[model samples]
Target: MIRAILLGLAALACLAGAAGLWLTRAHPVEAARFEGLTGDAEAGQTLFTAAGCASCHHAPDAEGDARLVLAGGQRFPSEFGTFVAPNISPDPDAGIGGWSLTDFASAVIRGVSPEGAHYYPAFPYTAYTRLEDQDVADLWAFLQTLPESDAQSIPHEVAFPFNIRRAVGAWKLLYLRNEWIRPAESTELERGRTLVEALAHCGECHTPRDALGGLRTGAWLAGAPNPSGDGTIPSLRPEDLDWSASDIAYYLESGFTPDFDSAGGHMAAVVANFAQLTAADREAVAAYVKALPPE
Candidate 1:
């Protein structure tokens, strides 16, 4: 009887190990989807700005033309830990200079690194997963045009099991749905949806998150506690904003509220970036925000 009990325990152990492996497997985007696609750097420039790539990857305090340099080392503190952004510059040794278009697309849209490891959600590839194929190709072309940086990536300051990058695969499995929060019936609204949901990743900040760090999709843009712990991120729902579409568009372009108060803190940089976009794009974003369900 004791021998049979030992054999049963061994069987359970093997089953548990198999379950773990299946749960943690990396699922990268297939390479075949990118065949024959050519990147357009000029078009990519617009997508890059909308995606806010430089906002996290650029050297802190870099000003003027220096902001274009992608020597990354910005620290973001969260419930998980402090996540240090990596150098995404064209440096052959320290950055992604050697990566192919497939490598880039997989990392951006699927959160799978070139080494076939899962990237932490701090990179925000969850929203980026919705990016159109051509947009990803265009962004790849634009990245190659940037100046190279030799800065080595700073490792994240996570503790225990959280530091295990493979564990992120489970997190992705739970949270990585590519569905849009809101549907659009018009072309302009569709453009706005792409900009808001895919490129801008606005929901990453505005939507509340669950205890395990998965976004609370039911809340959508109903505002969240600032991870920085200063205050709420402010709901973008129509009732909370209480502004006309034009008012929101003006705020995005000029950083000024309807009351004429200038935007401060992190929003200042966001306004600066949005200012580079076309007037119609800003209007579309505003229209989309106004169309959101009330909190």
Candidate 2:
């Protein structure tokens, strides 16, 4: 009787393990949602610039018009490992040229790849998952218009369990969220919220994370250690910034602070992107930043 009971317990444990794996598998979006959608390249350029796609995807040290080439060799050092951005140009072999709209949508919003594998959170799909389908479609259209590059993608330098792509599924189950961190109360705020929370993914840098790499939502945009080991990413809370809405807007456009200090380090690239936006859009972002509560 004792032997039989032990065997049953072992069988139950095996079943539980299998259930866990199944629960953590990649979850792609329904292809039906994009059925009638068409992309506008003009609008997509706006989204692409706002999203700062070139900052990480451009060839290392690329400047001027060369920045437009998304050859993808930028290295992002993190606690997990150094993640090499992948080639996202229009090359069918080296990039995403062959990807279908469903594949793109799933990769963008669900953090699932075309081959049904989970993408590491280094890609920041957690924030992107909140993006509207139409904006994603536009981005896709804009991507196709760019020059193709034959440059190959470099592999990420991760170790053991962290290197296992399948393991990311489990991580996603814990950290991935579709809900907005700061829901908007008005139409103007809504635009700013979408830009900051979804498209630009400001919180991906500013928000601190848990031991499991899950964002600490309770202290949203309260700042985090720079993943690249430079220094702390500063808090965007109103108390910390202490800038007027106009001041913030001006800084975003010109990269200058009220004290006349200019944006340096990675923020310079961000300022470059924001400068591409319309004056009204910059003000909207400023308003949103000014409205943030201290965490």
Candidate 3:
């Protein structure tokens, strides 16, 4: 009886040790690829708008050009909890002004902060993870040009276990891949794949996730229940859309379908972001979606 009891305790310890090892695994890809690359602030600014940095980081109700100041107080309500955006402005004290390009790139690309802690995926670094090294440098430089606000970062309100940021490392290990979730078919799709999967992060909203909050890549962009709102996020498979490439591109440009139906819900903000992209980029995205095999 004593021997059996001792073996049981030892087994439990081994199990706990293995679990800890899995949970603490890190995604430590090198950010030094951006090192020695000089960024063009003008180009970075364009990428910034494309990446929709202002959508969350901009101060509430900041209209027109005032959106350039990233004060980061916007609140995002989700099933997990309410998330508050953080300051990414250039202020040395309250913003990223003091951070090296390496520091900024590390967080944006790998979701690892300068302090080496795992950042909550709410920051959308998973999509940013696919950004080109040059783009990262340019984006960081452009961020430096933005006006800084000293607004205090608001804490995200989440329940127990979810509140533990360290656990995010495990989640990243499971879901945070830096490659295409769906295989690309043609060269034409390569550009759109980069835009849709990387900067736009359309899948982050459209793709259904498991209970653990990892994206259901098998469904790809087949839609999910909206986490921030009370409706379903419609799927984007070609059969789901059934529209020609021109139709998709036009809707992206004007937010109006060929049938005169307008974009609504969270898609309004997404449409606004798409409207800012170049005409060719919109066409490319539409082409990519049009080329998809319907589910």
For TM-score, the strongest prediction is: 2
Q: Go through the candidates in order and give the C-alpha RMSD of each one to the true structure.
A: 1.2, 1.0, 2.3
Query: Candidate 1's residue-wise lDDT over 1-295, tens digit each?
Result: 9999999999999998889888888887788989779999999999999889998899989988888889999888898999999999999889999999999999999999999999989898999999889999999999999999999999989998798887898898899988888988788889899989999899988899999999999889889998877788988887777989999899999999999999876778788889999999999998898788775
Please list the C-alpha lDDT of all candidates, in the order they appear: 0.90, 0.90, 0.84
- Comparing 2 with 3 on lDDT, the higher-scoring candidate is 2
Q: What is the lDDT of residue 237 in candidate 3?
A: 90
- In model 3, which regions exceed 4 Å deviation? 1-31, 185-187
Give per-model TM-scores.
0.97, 0.97, 0.91
> Which residue pairs clash in candidate 2?
none
Name the 10 consecutive residues with the lowest summed lDDT in model 1.
263-272
Give the backbone clash total of model 1: 0
What's the best-to-worst order under lDDT?
1, 2, 3
Q: Is candidate 1 or candidate 2 better by TM-score?
A: 2
